[model samples]
Every structure is written in structure tokens, then in C-alpha cells.
Target: MNMSEWLVRTARRVPDAPALLSGENVAASYSEFAANAARIGGLLRTRHKVEPGDRVAIFMKNSTAYLELLYGVWFAGAVAVPINAKLHPREAAFIVEDSGSKVLFVSGAEELHSLLASTCTVHDIEAEPTFAAEGAAIAAPEPRAPDDLAWLFYTSGTTGKPKGVMLTNANLHAMTYAYFVDVDDVLAEDAAVYAAPLSHGAGLYNFMHVLRGSRHVVPLSGGFDAVELSALVPRLGNVTMFAAPTMISRWLTTARETGYSGEGLRTIVYGGGPMYQADIEAAVAHFGPRFVQIYGQGECPMTITSLSRSDIIDRAHPRWRERLASVGPAQSCVSVRVVDADGAEQPPSEIGEIVVSGAPVMKGYWNNPDATAQSIKDGWLWTGDIGTLDEDGYLTLRDRSKDVIISGGTNIYPREVEEALLMHPAVSEVSVIGRPNAQWGEEVVAVIVASTDRPPNPEELDAHCRSLIAGFKRPRAYFFETALPKNNYGKVLKTELRKNVSGL
Candidate 1:
């Protein structure tokens, strides 16, 4: 089924229901949203000559217009390539050129014209006469096979240059279904805030909310600002949003200081990075049981293992702490396994590479057959993350295989040490890596961002680690920095850190 059909079906059921919001103002009702999308789709076909399977890119910040163009691309049976608005001009152009997007829908980011110069035709979505032109009635929803491409998601490119992940209509449908059963329960009155980058997970979640005929709200700030989010949440009742862990930490600190109780927040689905156990525990204490964590990659747009809201608040359970540390069990509609080097499944509690096979898995890396082959073997996508599945089926992520620290032939997962250090009051953000050592092959090095202006003593940090984890796992050395280098999505750029260490 064409994924756009969800909007059509929901509009027919609740024509007058609110569908889009700008802060508290109603941007469009379900019927109006559908009509706008159809009109935009008509413009894409008649004006831009966009055909089935053609690629159309949108390089704009979070706004109602961005969402309209996205659904319109899908409605027109073309693939939507939503580039991160914060990406370097060169980086953004790479995605546009790589995806072969014929027309780029831009919204006043004058930077984009110079960025995508001579690459693709740029259409100012706001100024497009066809976008505002009326009398373009709702046309028949384009027919697309389940396997046809729906979205071309570009990876954040920490490891190398970005690769386009080809998410199919079937993959998105599965994600929408998973959100309902495994993520959260959404009602027609429930609204979702697009506080994170709409180009990434936050935008992908539009499917889940729209499928339920819920409202899609873009904050006045256009992006996340804890103060703005704090004020907006209470005004928009029963609101849910997808945020990165860093964004949540900021909200937690802001709430505590300003005494903002986060009223009317239904759920915050956090992913993109590990939410330290200490951080999540504090969040639960302040927010009161309203966070869901999902662990997935670009290859699988956000349907892998999910740590539900129930798992966050059930602290009285004997295994609650252990479960909280885990990313949770395999989400509904996917088969997760921990496989050894030879592609054999590992026994319970044995750490191995996590692999997933499901409908939500991508078709392949766009135009990169070698990468596609390396990632997907048979039907499973070999996620580079190493993890273990307990007897009860909970998966505890050890670390990304590339980030493992090997000291004296012993493998030490960086997450283990990072979590231990995060427990220290002085430590705020830490990234543990292996530095080259002649004798041990690699020595554990902890790069930290202290909570205060005064850097925490290295000995004190090491002493704290000794109390929480094994002695061998303690950092042999520590480096203090004002902040850790991170990508636009807030994931630490460990590759850049490695380069810094190499120079040292």
C-alpha cells in the first residue's frame, strides 16, 4: 500500500480533526492537510515534472511547509530526500547530488542556493506560485509497490562520507505499526512536537503520529530550546516528541533550575545516543515515567529494540536496573540476534554483533553496492553494535564494535567505563576510547567534560571508576575538555577524537 494512503484514510475519518500546529495555532486540519499535500503533489507532477520513483529533496528547517512538501513527495510517488539543515553546504550538496534529486524544495535558506549550485534546480517552496495556487484538487494517490523507495536517509557520516539509506514503503509501514504496538499509544487528541531535526528520526516519526490522525506541531523556535520546549509542552496538551539524549539532559537540568514540571508531556522517545543510566534515573525522578528509548540505525529507520515507558518507571522490579541499562528486547515485527564472527547465533549472555531481520530494514545503500553487500548478509542487517541477549531476551548493548577498547588482550566496552564515570557528580559528558600503546596494544583513555568550571581531578575520577567497575576497566589517563565533539544529531564524533589523540 502507498504510505501516503494513511493520510488519505485518516482525513476521511476525521476531516475536522486538527492535523498540523504551529505552537498552539492550528496550521491545518486533517482535511486541509490532505488537500495541501494533494495540491503540493499536483504541483510536483505538473509544475516540476516529478515522476514516479524520481528523487525530490527538501532542505529546510522544521516547519509546517516542510512537512507538507515531504508528504507531497510521497503522495506524488517520488522518493523524499530530507537533508539535515545544519549540514555544511558541501555536505548537503553531496546528498542532493548523490540522491539525484532533480528539484530541491527550499524555504528561504539562501545558503542552499549557493550550496546546491548547478547541482539541482532549487524551488523556493514558499514562493512557488503552484504551491499557493488553488483549484488543484486532490488527485488519486499514486500507486507504489511495498518495496519501492519512500525515503532516502543520509547517514550522519561520522565513520566516512554519508551514504543514502533506501527506506522502502514497506519499511515505513512496519515502523508505523511498531510505533503503535511497541513505542506508545497515540490518540487523535495527542500532539507531537518537532523539536529535533525533522530530517532525521523526528521527521521519520511523522508517519506514526499522522497514521493516528494526531497533530504535528513545529515549535516557534524551529528547533529545540529547553526553555521554549518547557513553555510549549504545557500549552499543547498530551504532547509527545522524539529527542536525542543530549536534548533530554538539557531539559532535565532546565526543569530542575526553573521549576518547570513539564506539564502535559505524554512521551519523549529518545534515541541517537546512549542515555546514561545516571541521566535516565534522574530524568525519571523529575519527569515521572514519560520516556521511551528506541535503538535503531539508518539502515532501519527506528524500529529495532525499544525500551518502553513501563520499563523506565518499574524500578521496584528485581531486574529493573539491568533492564534500564539495556536498550530493551527486540521490538515487535523484528527478529534480533547476537551473532558470532561466523554468522552463528551466540548463546544467552554471550556478547556478539547485533543483527536484525525485519520489514523495516532498508532496501540497500543507495548507489553503493559494496557497502550494501557488507552491511546486509542474506536478509539480516549486521548492525556494527556489539551486544548480548540475556536468557529473558533483553539485549544489553556492550559497545559499537569499532569503539571497543582492547587492553592487554582484554576487550573493554567503552560504554561500561563511560557509564561508571557518568555516575560521578563531577563528570557530565565523557567519551572513552582506546589510545595506542606499544605494550598493551591499546590503553584506555577517558576524555571528559566536567560539570563545573574546575576540572575534576584525574585521580578522583579514576577512584570513582574503581568503586563502580573493575580496576582494569578504569581509565589509565584522562583528558579534560570544555565539551565533547558531536555531530548535528548530538552523537559524539569519536573519529575526530581519535585524530586528536593521534596528533598528541
Candidate 2:
């Protein structure tokens, strides 16, 4: 079944419900939203000659029209390839050419049409969507099989160029079901805010809200703005938004400085990067029980594991803090394991490569059979993350396999060191990386972002590390900075940082 069927079904049940919004104002009702998608589908099939099984790319920022184009692609049984609007034109063009997309719908980036060197026809979303609203309508969505491709997601390439992960209709169905079972539940009165990029995990969350006939809101700022959100929430009550850890920290800071209480915001599902304990602890203390955590990569598409709202706020349990530090148990649709290199499962409390097998795993990488075979062994997809599983089934991430630093034949995880350093009063943010040493092979080093009120003393930080973690795990040196560099997704660019290590 095509995923667009959910939109059609909801429109039939609740034609007058709010379906799309721009800030606090409603842009389209459920009936109008579904009709717009059908007309856009007609434009794809009749005007652009897009057919079933073809790929259509969307390089757009968050907008009310973005959802229309996405469902429009699905209505025609074509695959949707959404690229981050922040990506360079060359990088976005590479994805368009590699996917062999039939058409590219661009928003916000006007120069894309002129600069894009691909054969795919480029359409300005601001203009084409208007034509779609008036064009002939498709009678119904094109039929799609369970295993047919639905979404093509590209991985963040820290090491090399990115590869496209192929997600099928069945895989998306499983992920949506898991969201209701393991993540937060959506209501018709709730509105999902698009603060993060619509090209990644936040975009994948649209299905549940659409299925329940809820409002899909794109902020007036087009992206995360603390002032915009704090004011918008009151107009549209019972709001939920997917956010990264850095966004949560920023939200907390805004709340503290302005005394803006979290009154209308319902929940913020945080993931896509490590949420250090100190950051989450402060967020929970300020916002009460409004945060949930999920752990997954592009391969699994946000269905691997989840730390629920109840578990996050359960301070009554003796091991609550330990559980809080974990990514929580395996979600309903998947089996997670920590395994050795030889594909054997590691015992409890031993760190190893984390692997998963389930309904939500992708079909494979697009047009790369060899890479697909290398990643998925037998029946399991070997996630490149390094982590351990405890006796009660909770999984704790150590670091990425490549990020693990070996010093004098002993492995040192950066999270352990970084977690310790963050507990200091003056330590605002920190990232840990290994520096090459002839004597020790690699020595642990810390990059600190100190608070404006009190800059940390290196000697005091060393004592703080001594009190929390092992001596050898402590940083051998420190570099103070105003901020660490991050990728578009808010993950610390350790690879970029490693390039500057010798000078630092």
C-alpha cells in the first residue's frame, strides 16, 4: 500500500480539521491538503512524465508546501529524496544526479536551478505548488507494493561521500507503528512543529500526525527560533516537535534567560546526537517530564530504541540514573545486540559493535550491492556504533567504532571522559578526541567551551576528572574555545577537529 493512503483516509474522516499551518494561522484543511497532493501528483504524471518507481528530489527548507510535495510524490508511487537545504549546491546536485531523479523541487535556494548540472528538471516550489493547486487531479494514488522503495535517505559522510539508504513502504509502516507503541502518541488536537530539517528524522515523523488528522506547522522563521517557538506555542496548544540535543540545550538557555515557562509545549523527542547526562538533567529539571530520547541511524530510520517519558522522570527507582544514562531497551519491532567482530554476541556489560535485525531496517543502499552486503551480514544490519547491553536489556553507547581511541594497547571511550568533564561548574561544553603520541600511541585531549561567568582552570578540571573517572581516562591536555565546530546536524565534527590537533 502507498503511504499516501493515510492522508486520503484522514481527509475522509475529518475534512474540516486543520491539516497544515504557517506559524499560528491555518493554511489548509484536511480536504484541501489531500486535494493539493492529488493535483501535484497529476502534475508529476501528466506534465513531468514521472512514473511509478521513479525518484523525485526535494531540496527545501521547512515550509507548509514541503509536506504537499512529499505526499504528492507518494501519490504518484515515486520515491522521495529530500536533501538538506543547508547543503552546498554541488553536494545537492550530486544526490540528484546519483538518484537519477525525474524532477527536483527546490525551495529557498533560487540559484539551484541555474547551478544544478543534473539532467533532472528543476522546479521552484514557490511557483510550481501554485500550478499544482489549480492543475487536474489524480483520481487516486498509484498502487505500491510493500517492498517497493518509498524514501531514499543519504547518510552523513564524515569519512567519505554519502551513500543513499533505501527505505521501502513496509519499512516505513513498521517505523510508524513503533512510534505509537514506543515513542509518544499523537492526538488530533496536537501540532507537530518543523524546527529541524524536513529532510531527516524530523520529516519521517510526519506520518503519525497526518494519520491522526493533526496540524503540521512550519515556523515563520523556517527553522528553530526560541522566540518564535515560545510565542507560537500558546496560539497552537498541545505541540510536539523533534529536536536534537543542541537544540534542547539552546531552548533551555532561552527559557532560563527570559523566564519563558514551557507552558504550551507538550513534548520534544531528542536524538540524532549524543544527549550528555548533564544537559538532559538540566532540561528535565526545568521542563519537567516533557522530553523523550530515541536512538537510531539512517539505516534504521528512528526505530531502534527509545527512552520513554516515564523512565526519564522515574527518580523513585534505585537505578533510575543508570537507566537514564542508557538509550533504553530495544523498541517493539527490533532486536538489538552487542556483538564481537566474529558475529558472536558479547556478554552483558561488555562493549562491542551494536547490531540490529527487524522489520524497520532498510532494504539496502541504493545502486551499491557490494556496500549493502558489507553492512548487512546474514540477516542483521551491523550498526557501526560501539555500545554495551546490560542484564536488564538496556543499551549504553560508548562511542563510534572509529571514535574509540587506543592508548598503550588499552581502549579509551571519549564519552566517559567528556561525561566527567561536563560535571564541572565552569565547563559549559566539551568534546574529547585522541591526539597522536609517539610514546602512548594516542593521548586523550579535551576541547573545552567554558561558561562566560567562570572560565575553567585546567588544574581544577583535572581534579574534577580525577574525582569522577579513572586517572588514565583523564585528559592529558586541554584547549579552551568559544565553541566547537559542528556539522549541520549538530554533531561535533571530530574529524574536522582532528585535522587541527597538531596546531592546538
Best by lDDT: 2
CA lDDT scores, all candidates in order:
0.84, 0.86
Model 2 per-residue lDDT tens digits across residues 1-504:
999999999999999999999998899999999999998899899888999999999998889989999999999999999987766565677788889999999965665666667678888866755768665888889999999999999764333355899999999999999999999999999999999888988899999999999999999999988878888887788999998776777778888988877888899998876676877898999988999999988899898999999999898988888889999999999999999999999999998999999999999999989889988998899988999998999999987765766554344668767877888878899998998764455689999899866787889998888765557778999998889999899999998777878556
Off by over 4 Å in 1: 115-119, 126-130, 156-159, 402-504
**Maximum-TM-score candidate:** 2
Cα lDDT of model 1 by residue, 1-504, tens digit? 777899999999999999898988998999988888888788778867889999999888899888878888888899999987765455677788889998898777676577665557788866763553553644867999999999999873334366899999999999989998999988888899999888989999998788889999999889888898888889888999998776787788889999987698999998876667988898989888899999988798788999989988887889999999999999998999999998999999998999999989999999989989989999999998899999888999887765766554344668767877988988899998888764345678889999988888988887887765557778888998898999999999998888888546
TM-score for all models, in order of appearance: 0.80, 0.81
Error of 2 at 86 (Å): 0.8
